[model samples]
Target chain A: AQRVTQPEKLLSVFKGAPVELKCNYSYSGSPELFWYVQYSRQRLQLLLRHISRESIKGFTADLNKGETSFHLKKPFAQEEDSAMYYCALSYSGGGADGLTFGKGTHLIIQP
Target chain B: DAGVTQSPTHLIKTRGQHVTLRCSPISGHKSVSWYQQVLGQGPQFIFQYYEKEERGRGNFPDRFSARQFPNYSSELNVNALLLGDSALYLCASSFGTASYEQYFGPGTRLTVT
Candidate 1:
């Protein structure tokens, strides 16, 4: 079974500081990875996907096949960046399947 | 365009009772998926539907069931609910199957007493 692991349950960073949310996955085949975020009282939304390779809201993640990791990164964290972040994976990468999600990390940006 | 939407934003039910949650996908989306999010935990996959047909399902018990409509909307029904069933139920929609990025709904909070 494919499983996503997000080691940190909470992460705190100062404004303008760099932030990295760790995410590692265990899947046998090529998998599609994504980062989803939920703001306070807001619905969950997609932050970015590895296949796109494009940054959203100054956040970027690179899929490392060798290490089976897809860590989210931002050079400068902003106070508004505080939210819950989830790392999700789709094992088949092709079929209409549900994503397996990590427990999520609560990101707190202190001003 | 509207994102995925769920109805009955919040609900409370007693144990052994049944409940139904509804979801409407984005205007052009054809695939819908359901998930359960417990407190302090990640969302767990429940079911996936595309083109009014069942495509995939997660490791859930038979008490959990869902169906897609011809219009692409979907409904999740849980039978004989337990206290453990209390959680936030999420609905996601996409243009295609798992190959496409899924858009999530605001989620319906269900509490089983």
Candidate 2:
């Protein structure tokens, strides 16, 4: 079975500081990776996907097939960047099957 | 366009009772997926429906069932609710069965007492 692991339950960072949210997965084959974010009082939304290879809101995650990791990072964190981040994996490239999600990390950006 | 929408933003049910949650996908969307999110945990996949057919299902118990309507809306029925069933239920929708992007609804907070 595929499982996603996000080691950190909470991460606190100062404004403008670099941020990294660790994520690892256990999957037998290549899987599609994604980062989903949920802001306070807002619904969950997609932040980035590995296949796209494009940064969103200064956040980027690279899928490391060798290590089975897909860590989310940002060079400069803003106060508004604080949110709950979940790392998810989908066995099917197109997400037809469904996703296995990590417990999630609560990121707090202190001004 | 409106994102996915769920009904009865919140619900309270007694143990052993049955409850139904509704979801309406965004305009033109044809696939809907259901998830259960307990406090302090990420959402867990429950079921996925496309074109009114069950396309995917998670390891949830048989008490949990779902169906999609011809108009693309969906409903999740939970039977014999337990205290552990109290959580936020999120509904997501995409354009097709294979679409990678899914729009999420606000979610329904179900409390089983």
Candidate 3:
């Protein structure tokens, strides 16, 4: 079975502090991991994907296949970074069938 | 161009009633997918339609159905609604079947009494 787990339901950090949201997945094949964020009064949007290997809004995530983890990290957290984040995974089949999502983590950046 | 759009931002219905939620995909997008997001939970895939054909469906009952028009717009219909059916119905659209990035709408909040 394919599953994504976000252990923390809520996380809080002071501004300018580093932030890390943990995510783990269970899948048999190569997985495509993604980070999605939802801001207040805004629709859910893509934050970054592990395959892209590019940073978005100063946030980055690395896919560690050995541990089956794709953790999202930011060197310094900002108040605006407080939002609900979700971790998603897609198989390498190159289609819509592979996408699976985690429960979600709420990050609170306290000023 | 506008992003994905869903109609009736909020709706109220009773149990055993039927309701239809409409969605318009982003301009030039050919694939549309529907998801159900309950309170305090992540969204769950309901249906995926590309080129007016049903490509995939999640673990939902037949009481839930959907159709996509030639213009790529879509509608989701739920019949014999149960109290558990109350949720936020989200619509997402992408340019092609292979496009991994999907734009989502604000979603329609359905309240079943």
Candidate 4:
């Protein structure tokens, strides 16, 4: 079974400081990973996907196949960036395809 | 154009009762997926429908069911709801079944009493 793990339940960092949201996955085949963010009382929104390799909101995530990790990183965090982050793995099996998500990590960027 | 829309922003029901939640995918999007988010937890995929057919279903039991309409809109129905079923139900839409990037709608918060 494929699974995504986000070890940190909450991470607090000062504004303008670097931020890294850790994510690791367990899958045997080629994997597609993504990071999704949810603002307070808002729906989850896709932040970035490893396939795109495009940066969004100054955040980037590189999928390391060796480490089986796709950690989200930003050089300088902003107050508005505070939100809940989830790591997702795309799973395709037996005609059933869906995303398996981590428990989620709450990020707090303090000014 | 409007984004994905979910009806009844909030709902309350009792144990053993049944409830239905509706969602309309963004225009031109043929795929709709349902997720359940427990308090303080990430959303769990429940069902995915494309072109009026069931494409995917999660580990949820048979008490949960869903269907897609010709217009691409979808509805999730829960039978014999339990208190543990309380959570925010989110609807996600993608251009196709293979489209990995999904757009999510403001979830309908279901509180089972």
Candidate 5:
């Protein structure tokens, strides 16, 4: 079965400090990876996808197939960057085989 | 264009009761997927519908059912609901299967007591 894992339940980082939200997925072959974010009182939204290879909100994630991971990284954490981050894996199939999401990590940027 | 939308932003029901949730996909989107998100957990896949047909289903019980319409709208029905059903129900829409990424709605907060 396919699965996504986010080992950290909660992570605290001071402003301007580097931050990394760990994410690992279990899937066969090359898989699409994504990072979604949900701010307090806000709906979940797409932050970035590995296919695009583009950075959003200064956050970037590289799909490391060798490590079976796609960890979210940011050079300098900001107060506004604090939110719930989820790592998801998409399966290329028809039917209700939607994206498999991780348990999510609560990133708290301490001021 | 408007993003995906879901009705009944908040709902509260007692155990054993029934509840129905609705979702409208973004214009031009032919696929709609449903998920259940409990507090402090990621959303779990529930169902997927495309072109008014059931494409995929998750590891849910028969009590959980859903259908899509010709207009790309969808409804999720939960019969004999249980307390564990309390969670946020999110609806996502996409153009087609495969490489197309999904866009999500605000989600409906369902609370079963």
Candidate 6:
């Protein structure tokens, strides 16, 4: 069975502190991972994807295949960054199927 | 351009009643998917449609059904709704099947009594 696990339900940090949200997955095939964020009173939006290896809003995630982990990291947390974050995984079939998501983690950045 | 849109931002229903939620995909998008998100939980996939055909479905029960029109918009229908069915139903659209980036709508909050 394919599953994505985000152990931390809530993570709180100071405005200038570094943050890390851990995510791990169990799948038999190559995985395409993504990080999505939902701000208060706003729609859920894509924050970044492992395939692009690009950072959004100073946030970056590195996929460690050996560890089966894709942890999102930021050098400094901002007050506006406080939101619910989810980690999603999709198979490499290039099809509409194969996307699975984790339960999500709530990050609270304090001023 | 307008993002994905869902109708009936909020709905209240009673047990044993049936309900239909509508969604309009983003323009130029050919793929649409439906998900159910309970409070404090991640969105669970319900169905995926491409070119007006069912491409994939999640592990939901038969009580849940959906269809896509020629224009690529879709609707999700639930029969004999149960109290546990209350959730935030979300609709997402993408350019194509391979597009991993899914734009999500604000979602419809369904409350079952």
TM-score, predicted candidate 6 vs. hidden true structure: 0.97
Candidate 5, residues B1-113: lDDT per residue as tens digits? Answer: 77998999999999999999999999999989999999989999899888889888889999999999989999999999999999999999988854236888999999998
lDDT of 5 by residue, A23-106 (tens): 999989667888999999877888998988998999999989999999999999999999999998877642257778999999
Name the lDDT of candidate 4. 0.91
The DockQ value obtained for model 3 is 0.56
> How close is every model to the real structure, measured as TM-score?
0.97, 0.98, 0.97, 0.96, 0.93, 0.97
Chain A TM-scores of all predicted models: 0.98, 0.97, 0.96, 0.96, 0.95, 0.96
Summed over model 2, clashes come to 0
Candidate 4 regions exceeding 4 Å error are A93-96
Instruction: Compare the candidates by lDDT and give the number of the best one.
Output: 1
Candidate 6 residue runs with Cα over 4 Å from true position: A92-94
lDDT of 2 at B3: 85
Give the winner by TM-score.
Answer: 2
**lDDT of all predictions:** 0.94, 0.93, 0.90, 0.91, 0.90, 0.91
- Candidate 4 residue-wise lDDT, B1-113, digit = tens: 67999999999999999999999998899999999999977889899998999988899999999999999999999999999999999999988876365899999999999
* Tens-digit lDDT string for candidate 3 (A36-70): 89998999998988878999999999999999999
TM-score of chain B of each: 0.97, 0.97, 0.97, 0.97, 0.96, 0.97
**Order of quality (lDDT):** 1, 2, 4, 6, 5, 3
Candidate closer to the true structure by TM-score (higher is better), 4 or 6? 6
Tens digits of per-residue lDDT for model 3 on B4-93?
999999999999999999999999999998999999888888888999998878789999999999899999999999999999999989
Candidates 1 onward: DockQ, in order: 0.74, 0.71, 0.56, 0.54, 0.59, 0.66
Model 5 alpha-carbon miss at residue A103, Å? 0.9
lDDT, candidate 2, A1-111, per-residue tens: 999999999999999999999999999988899999999999999899999999999999999999999999999999999999999988877666888889999999999
Q: How far is candidate 4 from the true structure (C-alpha RMSD, Å)?
A: 1.6
